[model samples]
Target: MASSSTPSVRDHASGRLKRAASTLAEDTQSLVSEIKKAFTMVKNIAVDLEREKESTKVKELETLAVQLSESCDNCIRHASAIHTVGNEYQPTSELTDFKKLLDEQFMKLKAMPSQNDRLIRQFQEAVWNVHHKGQPMPGEEEEDIVMTSTQSNLLNVKCPLSGKMITDLAEPVRSMDCKHIYEKEAVIAYLPRNGNKKQCCIAGCPKFLQAHRLVCDPFLLTEIDELRSMNQQTEQAQNVEDFTGLDDED
Candidate 1:
């Protein structure tokens, strides 16, 4: 039996496991934040072809973010299990030290650069496939190919419910159902809070809208900004041409 003041081996192991899980969760969250920041930067570049490539890279980053999030959830689950088992069951002589195992695995994960390499390889392969029309040279192995966005799936920036442009809305969200965007508050108001389904605001659309289906679309918001910037520049150039002709006439 353990002394009253001192923790038993089971209790000590449980505490160590909890700390390991907590550290993993925090670090995972920090990595997610960094990914978001990098995503924003990638979206801000002006060239169209470059933007397309960056978009592919961003998708890969998003996948990595999702994986890291799942890993964090698993860590939390494992920590909870450790707490439960430590409290209820007797600590056996051959009981696994999950803390040591997690620490070893976490250190290995941190040391591995294969994940980063894979992302870069996929990004490069996407760019190559785009340029080459997905045909590989005679000796090379086949790589995964990504298709460009088709015209029919593109979403208009204007909100279907309020007729407000994406740039004008304080918070814009996209519907995963019909690929339509809406002003977040407007759409929320349009749908009943009681969880009743509502028809999509856009005419001729068959999909139903629910609160869960609405997602924050940073990519759409970025596209809207790019479009607005291009339009402004075109108008400014036209104004310059008109002013030049007026001066010549004078």
Candidate 2:
């Protein structure tokens, strides 16, 4: 005959098995949630980077357009002066040649509109490289988690932007207006030039370029390069001091 406790022992074992199964299911669900959250975060970062890349390109093109317009104006002014001189000195060969050169320059200025599409395409390509492909997203750090399973799990992670190994993922520091992620120092360095001297670098924001603030992320070096180019143009314009300096004796 079987012992009286045999059925009770079986029941206890079955209950423990059901509880264990339930715990495992909960754990798996939690892990899935975490993975989903992580992927969403990464996607958001990519989008933000893309937007900033384009914005910077647009600003650069706009600045170039301004410079080109100024050049055209200067050419027009010179041409008028040549025409006046030609009228004063009726047979002046020099004034006639100058007028022809100015006409050619004017034609070139008119041709700039045709180049706009090409310039925009080039700018878009550049923005893509800066946003993706080469570097990791700014501010994110690689992390290694020791997930204990029935066996051991190991993961080798690298930062997307810097290619550095990091133990913890860094929190994103975003530009308040533009929501651009960058290292705090880099953001600060970029903020001063955005017109407000006191605002964030965001297009159309009332406080845009008004206040300077720092956030944390890898600085978009490509954006910095564009900014440097603009600065060089500005410096050159300033160094010229007077538009008539070319006609003046040094």
The most accurate candidate by TM-score is: 1
- Candidate 1, which ten residues in sequence have the lowest lDDT sum? 144-153
Model 2, total clashes:
12
* RMSD (Å) of each candidate, 1 decimal: 14.3, 33.1
Best by lDDT: 1
Q: Residue 50's C-alpha lDDT in candidate 1?
A: 44
**TM-score of every candidate relative to the true structure:** 0.39, 0.21
Candidate 2: residue 207 lDDT (0-100): 43
lDDT of 1 by residue, 76-156 (tens): 334333333333343445867757654554454455232333323334444444547447633564542222211112366
Q: Tell me the lDDT of model 1 at 87.
A: 32
lDDT of 2 by residue, 1-250 (tens): 3677766765665455444433443344344344334433433444465676656545555455444434433333333333323222223213346456546644644553332232233333344455464333344332211111011111212232333322233432444345433434344455546445554333344444323222221122212323344456457756776755765855
Which 10 successive residues of model 2 have the least lDDT summed?
Answer: 145-154
* Per-model lDDT: 0.55, 0.39
Off-target runs (Cα >4 Å) in candidate 1 are 1-154
How high is the lDDT of residue 21 in model 1? 42
